[model samples]
Target: MYLVHTAHWQFLGLTLGFLAWILTMVTAGLNEWRLWHMDDVSVITSGVAWVGIWKVCFYTHVLPQMEFCRRISMSDSFLPVEIPVAQVLMALAVICGLAGSISGGVAMRMVYFTVEDRRNIRLVFILTGTLYLFSGSCSLVPLVWNMNSVLINSTIDFPPEYYLPVVPVRQQVGTAIGVGIFASILMFISGLMFLCYKYARHTLRSVAPRSTSNPLRGPWTTTAQRSNGVNKGSDNPAFLSEEVSC
Candidate 1:
């Protein structure tokens, strides 16, 4: 018999995990952290800058001259002083999540393992669920670290004229941060679902009835018994069989 709840939860986990992975990849790659507006500035000379985790870009004030936008170079001294932590974490999260999804997908349904070996399926589920949880944790760490960095270091450095008139208001939180946070949460939830499914599978298997007949034993046959009867008292027999009454 098939386990309905296990399959349901596993399917849900895979779906949500894949969706979260897509969001993670998109948010990590895009450069939409900030939007800029220019007030009474000419397009030819005046420009507005936008910053993201990966790079920074400066664009002309005029909408028609957007093609003139240029990316600022990060390698001023021909080397980066620090590693790109955000990029690395997000990449690893995606990779691990993908592997977990594949394993979990295979483990949910046991079409290959014979009835005698079905117990091994639970082990696969446990392993995949653990990997998924790890992936979720990895996704969360980077996002929380980035958020903390932004909160502590976001004090206004530019002159008052550059931003809104509010004294305490510094920078606006970008869409990417929100998306990343949501994705991390979803990933965590998906991992939990997979784990729960694995537990349920184990519980079901433990309580299932065991068949008494040995799976390795072949069907009973009268020919073997007849051979044993003819060779009764011999030291060695051509065929092996259970004893038959005369």
Candidate 2:
């Protein structure tokens, strides 16, 4: 049985990629991306309102005061352009990040050694890194664009039924957007790690000359058991056992 080795780079990259993927999921579901403070308002009893990709949350003042949240409609004529774009980009980021995380997870198999070929290992690393890089890019676009919108105090032209301000004086970027930005940076670094792992693996292979005698090769295949640097055929009894008793 071959013993699999997990490189330091692969371990670290997978760990970070997993974290970023989780954060991306959370960011997609979170409703705190855009905040509006209505504390001093005479219109509604709610102190503040927050908007998310899927919903907009405010307060209702009927017989009993309650939080009222509504699903964001993409067909609404008055919605800011950033909201829809953020939704799509964030959704894409989640999907790509999940794929990259899985790839990274598979590449760092420590015990199974299922994929033993050096060429295959390098391919896995490259593919994993590229996916993560794309995930990071998808996450970053919405964050920066929405942040720019907030900086300019972007407004929604909602009808009266929506009960949302066109341009609130106290509106600002919310914590969720900041969290997404941080997650995007983490994803980018994680992608770099996997790519670096590929480069480092290549460098080590070049230094050690691993084609005929790779570190990844099982130790059971001793020097005497090899023919011209290649492992002896399975037909040879040497492959069965190094020492046998009669």
Candidate 3:
């Protein structure tokens, strides 16, 4: 019965999230290929693929049956129950996950161009890359923690045999917390790299030369003419000797 109440919305949200993830991945991949000349689009592509596959598995194979039991749980209520708060939270997590992944991909590309200092660029890449990884990981928590399952199983209205194997709530909460911590660390590192890059560039520009003399402006001949103060005809033997010697 809980599934009846939550499955449709949950599936809809998941479907939207999956499609967005796919789009972001494709866009990021093509952009990377065109701009960076690096051939490792697979790293981000694989994450999107995994999430999409999992979403399909949940929607087609798992949710329908779960919905049947959920419907039974809500039959007694005359008024449609208000949407579960958990569903709202899950939707937010999915959005954040997608955004983080896209941002991280862009940051990774930035690092490739920022490679004048390997240490600084490496730190930036790690930070932004981890932010995406953690965000995606956090998105899975809501799907896994479907609290509706626990409520339905605990109620006597649902038969014991019909109880579904819900993911433990503790596990879901733990995963979300872990990802949050990881993302925070990544953010800190990214901020540090940005500051360092700004400072380094500023220092370099301050001391660099504004202009340089041209080497091919006839320095040798100019010096000779200036010292002699008079021009000798090219036909003269003295001019020929001077030209040959100097």
Query: What C-alpha lDDT do the candidate models reach, one value each?
Result: 0.59, 0.78, 0.33
Model 1 Cα lDDT, one tens digit per residue, 109-153: 562333445666767767777777777777677667656654553
Best by TM-score: 2
Best candidate, lDDT:
2
Cα lDDT tens digits, model 2, 1-246, are: 233444676788889999999998898898888888765545556667887778887766652266677788677667788888888889999999999988887777622455445457777888889999999999899888888877777777767776777767677788899989899999999999888863333233345544654567655563345778887645567655655643
Write down the TM-score for model 2.
0.74
The runs of at least 3 residues in candidate 2 whose Cα sits more than 4 Å from the true structure, single-residue gaps closed, are 1-6, 39-43, 63-66, 110-112, 199-246
Q: Residue 62's C-alpha lDDT in candidate 1?
A: 50
Backbone clash count, each prediction separately: 0, 0, 6
The segments of candidate 1 whose C-alpha lies over 4 angstroms from its true place after superposition are 34-48, 61-83, 111-117, 153-169, 198-246
Indicate the TM-score of model 1.
0.60
